[model samples]
Target: MYRIGVDLGGTNIAVGIVDEKYKIIAQNSTKTKRERGAKAIVKDIALLIEDLLRKTGIKVDEICSAGIGVPGAVDTKKGVVTFSNNFDFKSTELKKMLKDTTGFDFFVANDANAAAFGEYIAGSGKGSDNFVLMTIGTGIGAGIVINGKIYTGVNGAAAEIGHTVIVKDGIPCSCGRKGCFERYASASALTSMAQNAAEENTNSELYKLCGGDIKKIEGRTVFAAIEKNDKTAGEVLDKFIEYLAVGVTNIVNALQPDVLAIGGGVSAAGDVLINPLKQRVQIEDYARFCELKTIIKAAVLSNDAGIIGAAYLDLT
Candidate 1:
């Protein structure tokens, strides 16, 4: 039987059809008009699923189950999205909504958690029972997989590693907490650092890249400057890496997962980012934990992770 995966994001909704081997056989996407309201969004999801099945020439009854990954707090047991900042979904019974509309069994999971499970089963974390999938985007989000399953705590809100405190009263975070790891370790943090550096170092090429407008500087601009061996850019990256290592070290010490799969735009910096993080984790993490050193690697699925992971929610 075929399985369907739906990734609901702020900007777009992606749907994929997968076979038993976890390969995406068919996929499609459409803009998410979240401003339209929750009911409209649910309607859009229904349509997306219909479109995907039609394109794949698969009968509705041939599908085993459909899974949805939403970017917010999820009540997996109740099949509801309790809260979502990207969409106006508050205690919405997503599974029932889709099931009533399509007459198919459906499951829902937190987007990050789903992506982590996807990676664990089909991507980088393959063959490992314990690992963490960290997505470093506008904010940091983590998915914890242990013993070949997603470890959602009693309330289904576990592994919120991003909001873990890194510094006391440091940078402000969207979660209203100060010194959250995301405030310092995400792509947004790097971009903000680059902008501030550009303003201070007028002679730096980053300033030129931003057209002398600090507000226009972004993480990619900083990475480009680092590639050119710009000292100012390198400094910004070094500090960012330090904060990342601090947070990662905590993960290693706490769970000692077999691997830590890093994903998201910031991870695109490649070895320039990985090497420093490795060095710091090696130094700060417990030496006993070093014996079973967690392999730190980039996520292989990239953008496809959410869709692929959503499809495997049945295993959860």
Candidate 2:
């Protein structure tokens, strides 16, 4: 028997067919034009699933179930998306729609939670029961896996690690809170830091990389500048890592998870990002409480984690 997973994102929707072993036998993706509205988006997903099953030669009866990971608040038990900023989906019965269209049992979960489960079961945290999967991209999102299961709390909205306060009155976050972890630790934060540094250090290579337009500076541009040993870029990265470590240290001290798996675009910095973060955890993570020896590592399933994890939600 097979299972289908759909990862619906702001720009694209990834669909995959997986075997019982959790290996993706066939995968495909299509652009998500959210302006087309919720109904169109659901239709697109249904079509993609149908096309994928045909391409993989898997019958509907041969599939055990289907799962969808949505980028928003989800009522998992009700199979509804409460609200989503990535698309025009609010109070929509996502699971029922898919089931009606494809005639398969379906499940729905928060995208980050799905990614976390995927990593825990088949990727980096495979052997660990308790860990935090933090995705540091445009925003920071986290999934808490405890006792070999995804913990969504009572309302299915727990593990919002990004909103954890880091500074008293520092940068403002989109969540209407000041000094949220994502404000300083995310890829968007790194890019913003680079742009601010470029403005102050006109002679820095980052200025040239941004074509002298601070507004054009991006996370990759800053990473490239740091690669060339640019002092200003390195300084921005150092500060960025410091804030990231501060938030992570807090998680370590509080949750005492067995591991912290870092994913998303910022994690691409690899050792440069992981090393200092680890050091900070050792130095300031309220170590007296739990002897925080939690291991920190990069996520193994880069892009496909959400799709694969969503597919396995039924098993969980």
Candidate 3:
């Protein structure tokens, strides 16, 4: 039988029909219109699911169950979104809402965790019992799978690796902390670093690439400058990689997952990012002496990971 997965984001609600082969056979999506409130958002999700089913000519009986991945702390056992700053959700009975609206059993999980589980079963983390996926976007988000299961702590809000401090009394973070890993290691951080470097080095390719306007500086801008053999851009990248390595080493020491997959926009640099990160982690990780090491690679599923992972939440 097929399964239904919903990726509920602040901006959009995406629904997918997953076949037995773990592929999304049909999909539908619409703006979340969250300002209309949680009830309206849930209603839209149900509508999307129905539309997908109708388009695919699949009956409700053909669906085994449905799952949702939300962007907030969730009480998975109770299907309640404990809190979500994005939607101002508080104690929202998400599971019951989906079931009442669609007449189907529903499972709920954090979106990042769902993506990691997707990779664990079908992508980079496949065949690994212990896995971790870190998506470094505007901020860094992490999901941990241990011993063949997603590890949501007692409160269902675990594996927040980004907020962990790597530099004592360093740059301030929006989370009201100093030196949080994301502040120095995320894609946003990389952009900021490149902009600042361009400002200081007027003759560098970074400055020319951004046309002397730091405001135009972006994550990809840095990579472009480095491709031009720019020294300043290279230095900025080295520092960014160093900071990222520190955070990665901390996670490796703490969890020692069998596989750690890197995702998000910056990871598109592929081996340019992964190769350096592996070299740095090799030198810094506490397990350097061990014959075996955690396999670090780029996540393969990309945007589809959340939907695929959500579809298989029943396995967790």
Candidate 4:
């Protein structure tokens, strides 16, 4: 049998037809067009699913349950999207709307949590029962898995590690908080740091990479400069990596999971990010010389994690 998985994001809505093996056998996508309102978006989602099923020639009976990954807080039991800042959604009854529009029931979860479950079951966390996934992109998102299950707490909103305060009275966060760990450690933070360095150090390779435009600086800017031995870029990278380590060390100290996996575009740096993280975490983690340590690795799945994980939302 097949299952439908929908990853509803601010920019796009991706639909996947996944088989029992967790493979996305068929897929479809469309712009979310949030400006059209949530009702239109939900209608488009239904249309997309029907189109995929028709193209694949899969009858409704051949499909099992469906799941959707929302980029916000979800009330799983209530099947409500409590909040989604990216889409400006609040208390959206996504599951009910889908059922009404398409006559199919679905499970819903936070997109990051779904991806973490996907990684735990089929990617980097495959062999471990307890896993942690840290995705560093425009922001920082974490997914925690324990005993082979997503560790969403009482109201299914646990493991928001990114919001934890790192530096008291530090930078402001979009969440209306100050000194959030994500503000200091996310790839966005790195890019901002790089942009400042590039603007200040015109002679550095980073500035050249950005073509003298500070707005053009990105996560790779500092790394490119570091390769060329640019002093300012190296300094920026060091500070960013140190900030990343501080939060990771906190996770290790708090949860002590079996594996800690990194995900998102920044993870593309691979060893450039991992090697330094290893060193910083080693020196800063609570159990420096423990017999067993959390195995830090990169997530194997790049972007399809949400699809696979969402497809398996009813696995329990």
Candidate 5:
């Protein structure tokens, strides 16, 4: 039997059909266009799922169930999205809506937690019982897995490591907190830092890389500038890594997962980001004296982690 996974993001809705091997055999996606509101989004998802089944020639009865990962606090037991700043969702009955539309049983989970479970079962965290995944995109999204289970806390909102304070009274976060880790270490934050550095150092390689248009600056710009040995880019990246390490160390100190994997766009930099981050996290980890330190690595599944994790939500 197969399963279906839906990764509902503010920007896109991705649906996939997965076989027992955890591989996506067929997939479809469409713009979320969240401005149209929640119900419309649910309808679009149902259409996409039907389209995928038609294309794959798989009957609805062939699938066991469907799972959805949302970017918000979810009440898994109730199948409700308790709150989602991205979607403006409040107590939305996501599971019931999806099931009503698709005629399938559904499971709902926080997107990051779903991604972590995907990695734990099939990617970087496959061999580790205790694992954590941090997807550093616009914001830092984290998921904690302990003894082969996703730890969603009593409120199904645990492991929001990004909202944890790194600096006292520092930059403000949209989550209404000051000095949140995402403000400094997220991929968006890295772009902001690069833009600032380019503005201040007009003659730097980073400025030339973006052709003097600060708006063109992105997470990749800094890495490109670094490739040209640009001191400004190096400085910006150093600080970014420092902040990222602080967040990683904080998580490590708290849970000390066997493997702490990094995902999302910035992780595409590979060793350029992981090497330094691993170094800093190791130095700052409270259990540095321990012989078996947490291993830091990049997430192998990339974007597929969320989909695959959502597909197998029953395992959680």
Candidate 6:
């Protein structure tokens, strides 16, 4: 029997049909248009799933189950999204909604955890017994896998490494905490740092790259400018790397996973981010004296990780 997986996000909903081999044979996508509210989006998700089955000629009875990866604190046992700033969701009962409409057993999990599981099963962590995934996008999200199973903690919010405090009272975080790691190590933080540098110096290459529009300074902006030997961009990247190293090293020290794969939009920088991050972790990790160190690398399955991982949620 095939399995269905949905990657539900604030901007879009991606649904996929995975065969027994974990290959996605068919998929569908749609804009979430989140302003429409939870019920509307849920309707769209059910519709999209139906559309996929129709196009692929797969009957509901041939499906093993369906699962969704949400971006908030999820009550996996209850199938509810407790809260999600991105989707503006609050205690939404998603599993029952889908199950009632689609007639398939539904499962739900945090998006980050699904991605980590996907990587562990088929991507960079394929051969590892212990795996950790860190996605550096607008905010940092992490997932942990040990003994071939996800460790969601007793409360289903265990691996939230982004909210961990790294620099007491240094920067404010959306979680209403001071000095959370994401405030300094996230892609948004990198762009903010680059913006400050460009604004402080009008002649900086950063200013030219963004055409004098600081709002256009994305995470890749600094890296592109650095390729041209831009001084201000280099400075911003150096500081960003330092903050990133702190977070990565902390993850290494705490989990000691066999493979710590990196994912998300910022990971597009490839070696530009991984090489330095590796060096920083090597020097900063508490187990530097140990003979074994976690192998840090990019996640091979970019956006598909969520869908594939969700497909295997039942097994996990």
Candidate lDDT values, in order = 0.87, 0.87, 0.91, 0.88, 0.93, 0.89
Question: Largest lDDT belongs to which candidate?
Answer: 5
Task: Order candidates by lDDT, high to low.
Answer: 5, 3, 6, 4, 1, 2
Off by over 4 Å in 2: 288-292
lDDT of 2 by residue, 71-179 (tens): 8888999998888877778898988887787677788999999999889888988888797899999899999999988888787777889998899997887788998
TM-score of every candidate relative to the true structure:
0.96, 0.95, 0.97, 0.95, 0.97, 0.95
Candidate 6 residue 165 Cα shift, in angstroms, is 1.2
Candidate 1 per-residue C-alpha lDDT over 60-97 given as tens digits, one digit per residue, 9 for 90 to 100:
87888788888888889889888887788889898898
TM-score of decoy 1: 0.96
C-alpha RMSD (angstroms) for model 3: 1.1
Candidate 2 is scored at a TM of: 0.95
Task: Assess candidate 2 and give its lDDT.
Answer: 0.87
lDDT of 1: 0.87
Please provide, for model 5 over 75-143, each residue's C-alpha lDDT reduced to its tens digit, 9 standing for 90 to 100: 988899999878878999998998888888889999999999999998999999899999999999999
Report the lDDT tens digits of candidate 3 across residue range 109-140.
99999999989999999999999999999889
Q: Candidate 5: how many backbone clashes?
A: 0
* Per-residue alpha-carbon lDDT of candidate 6 for residues 1-316, written as tens digits (9 for 90 to 100): 9999999887789999999877889998999898887788888888988999899999988998788899888899999888887886888888888777777778999999988998898899999999999998888899999999888887677788889999998787878999999999899899889999999988988999999999999888998998999999988988988998898888888889999998998888899888988998898888889888899999889988999999889978
In model 5, the Cα lDDT at residue 269 comes to 97
What does the lDDT read for residue 172 in candidate 3?
Answer: 93
Model 4: pairs clashing at backbone N, Cα or C within 3 Å:
none
**Pairs clashing in candidate 1?**
none
Residue 1 of model 4 has an lDDT of: 94
- Residue 302 of model 6 has an lDDT of 92
Question: lDDT, candidate 6, residue 184?
Answer: 94
Better of 2 and 6 by lDDT: 6
Give residue 292's error in model 2 in angstroms: 6.4
